[model samples]
Target: MRIGVVTFPGSLDDRDAGRAVRVAGGEAVALWHGDADLHGVDAVVLPGGFSYGDYLRCGAIARFAPVMQPLVDAARGGLPVLGICNGFQTLCESHLLPGALIRNDHRKFVCRDQRLRVESTATAWTSGYEQGQEIVVPLKNGEGGFVADQRTLDELEAEGRVVVRYLDDNPNGSYRDIAGITNARGNVVGLMPHPEHAVESLTGPTTDGLGFFTSVLEGLIRA
Candidate 1:
């Protein structure tokens, strides 16, 4: 399977995401932020970084990139998309996902090996994980706190759309310890942690993150 990783102006982990895709046995296609086409890839990853230097807001400027217009439309049509950290912020800013990522409640950047529990495996990016399974991955960000209205939060809970939840401590003070969420259709996912960083044990804290990439490939094959 082919997976595209988008590189925005300040995308620091785009290469890492591509490597993760290759490690998971898929072709990694490099996509640029200004490009208007998706190159016919089956799936896409918006890797983490300070897009547009995080000006205005974490993902405000990058949301307007030409690539994102097609991405948003494709995502709406059930194309699998995963947004990590700043990419999650971009998804929210683009209105592809609900909730906003605000400054950390502690007002500091956090970088650590965080434990997350797989809450729902119903999404394209999480089918390789078992429900309630705990995995450790790198989490790093300044504006990583997830915030949404109470009603929206309740709906997400009721619908089982909360994909990952922080284990042990709430690193960024995200609401209800939500580390990641999937869209209602389950094709799009957004998370504050860096799953791409944990796909290889040689370079990461664990290889647990590889499940995400593999899951997408498996989901596509099943489709």
Candidate 2:
């Protein structure tokens, strides 16, 4: 499988995401924000970073990039897509996913090894994790709080779209301690934690995050 990892102007983890894909035994294709072509990648990942310096909003400007148009269309067509950190913000700004990420409740940048519970394994990005399993991954963000209207939140809960929940403690004050969420179809996912950073045992806190990349590969194989 070939997975495309997009690199925006200030993307910090695009390479890490690509490495994770390769480590999971898939080919990694580099994609650019200004390009409209997806290069026929089977899946796509929007890595974390301060796109356009995070000026207008975390991902407000990025959603307007030329590449996003095709990405949005493909995601709607059931193509697997994963967005991490600022990428998650972009996904919300693009309206591909519900809810928004706001300033951390503490109004500070936080970086730590965060524990997360796998709430649902139905998504292409999380099928490798057992439901209700707890795993630790690296999380670092300034505006990582997730918020949505009561109706939307309830809808997500009712549909089992809450893919991962913060465990032990809520690091960013996300509503219902949500660390990650999936679209209704389970093809697109937006997560605040940086799973790419935890895919390698030599550098990361644990290899737990590798499950996410591997899960997508497994899903592709089954399809």
Candidate 3:
């Protein structure tokens, strides 16, 4: 499988995402934000980082990049899309996923190893994890808080769209301690944590994040 990792002007983890894909035994394709092509990648990942310096909201401006148009359409057509941190913000901004990301409730940028519960274990990006399993990965962001209206949150919860939940403690004050969520179709997923950052044992965080990338590969195989 060939996974495309998009790199916006200031994307901080594009390379790491690609490396993670390669490490997972998949081909990693570098995709430029300004280009409209997807380069025939089977899946796409929007990695973390401050794009366009985060000037007009976390991912508002980055969502308008030319490369994202095809992704929007493909995502709607059931192509797997995973967004981490800034990428998650972009996915929300693009309306591919529900809810909004706001400033952390503590009003500060946070960075640390975060424990997350695999709530759904069924999304295209999370199938490698067992349901209710806990995994630790690095999370860093300012606008990482996830919020949605009561009805929307209820629907997501009731329908099993809430993919991952914060375990132990809520690091970003996301509603219902949601760490990640999936679209109704289960093809598009977005989360605040950087799984790509924790793929290797040498990394400080646990190597549990490799599950995410490997999960997507399995998703493609099953498709």
Give lDDT tens digits, candidate 2, residues 1-223. 9999999999999999999999999999999999999989999999999999999899999999999999999999999999999999999999999999999999989999999999999999999999999999999999999999999999999999999999887998899999999999999999999989998889999999999999999999999
Q: Tell me the tens digit of each residue's lDDT in model 1 across 1-223.
A: 8999999999999999999999999999999999999999999999999999999999999999999999999999999999999889999999999999999999999999999999999999999999999999999999999999999999999999999999988998899999999999999999998889998879999999999999999998888
Instruction: Tell me the tens digit of each residue's lDDT in model 3 across 124-178.
Output: 8888899999989998989999999999999999999998888887887899999
Model 2: lDDT equals 0.95
Worst 10 residues of 2 by lDDT: 164-173
Backbone-clash count (model 1): 0
Residue 150 in model 1: lDDT: 100
TM-score of each: 0.99, 0.99, 0.98
Off by over 4 Å in 2: none
Q: Count the backbone clashes (under 3 Å) in each candidate.
A: 0, 0, 0
